[model samples]
Each structure stands twice: as C-alpha cells, then as structure tokens.
Target: MPQPMGQTGGWESYPLNPAVHPGKKVVFQYTAEMEVKTLVFTLIDKGHE
Candidate 1:
C-alpha cells in the first residue's frame, strides 16, 4: 500500500496499478477536527498504447 507523504498540502504524484479504472471516483475521509480544504484529482494521458 502507498502511504501519504505527510499531512501537508501540496502537489503529489503516485504510481497506480494499470488495472485501476480511469473513471473511478476517489474519496477522502478525515476527522471532524481536520478539514480537507482542497483536493485536486488529475489524470495525465500518455496517448493510446
């Protein structure tokens, strides 16, 4: 499993399994005390194989 680098906000990139679906929706779960101010999900295209 890939762990989050830390609890700070910035740009992050992770290598995902190729089997993962492209249209899947990601969810972020946090405690009431900690708030998720922003979330940016991006998918880069390398062109068709």
Candidate 2:
C-alpha cells in the first residue's frame, strides 16, 4: 500500500520506476510564482539483495 502523503513534505518526485542504478538529485520549479525546490534522494536498498 502507498504511504501517507503529507507525512513527507511539500511536493515530491520519485524515480520513474524501480531503477537498477541509484537515485539522482532532483530539482524543479513548482510555479513561476513559487520558489524552486531541490530534493536529494538516497537509495537505501534495492528491495533487498
């Protein structure tokens, strides 16, 4: 099941899908009126070795 949303943060973006490689730091614009945001993701595991 999907976890709760707001427990996290403002906006979010995950990997396109399960990826073989680790994650990449992501930053994008929400709206021109709003400020840009940066998200850094660290791959803890690949669904267990």
Candidate 3:
C-alpha cells in the first residue's frame, strides 16, 4: 500500500489508476497562470486515466 504525500485539492489526491491499483502512476499539476481555459484542459487530461 502507498500513503499520500500530503493533503491536496481532492483530484490531486485521487489514485492515478483505481482498478488495477498497480501503484505505478503518473501525477500532473500545473498552475492556471490566471488562464481559466488552460485549466480546463489540464482537468480534461486528468480524466484520461
């Protein structure tokens, strides 16, 4: 089992993959840079898991 690095804004704490739970995972985080549209894409990519 793996523990969390720390608290995050929910999605950032979700498992990179839930079913397999391989523990091999990829994490991505980026600032909106005050751009809302760019943040949308970042969230879209997160759902690709």
Better of 1 and 2 by lDDT: 1
Better of 1 and 3 by TM-score: 1
Model 3 CA deviation exceeding 4 Å by range: 1-13, 18-21, 34-49
Residue 23 of candidate 2: its Cα lDDT?
47
- TM-score result, candidate 3: 0.22
Worst ten-residue run, lDDT, model 3? 34-43
Residue pairs whose backbone atoms clash in candidate 3: none
Clashes of each: 0, 0, 0
Q: Mind giving the per-residue lDDT tens digits that candidate 2 earns over 1-49?
A: 1222343334444553455544433333233334434445544454654
Off by over 4 Å in 1: 1-9, 22-36, 46-49
What are the models' TM-scores? Answer: 0.27, 0.27, 0.22
Using alpha carbons, what is the TM-score of model 2?
A: 0.27
Off by over 4 Å in 2: 1-9, 16-34, 44-49
**Candidate 2, pairs of clashing residues:** none
Native-referenced Cα lDDT, model 2: 0.41
RMSD of 3: 10.7
Give me the candidate number with maximum lDDT: 1
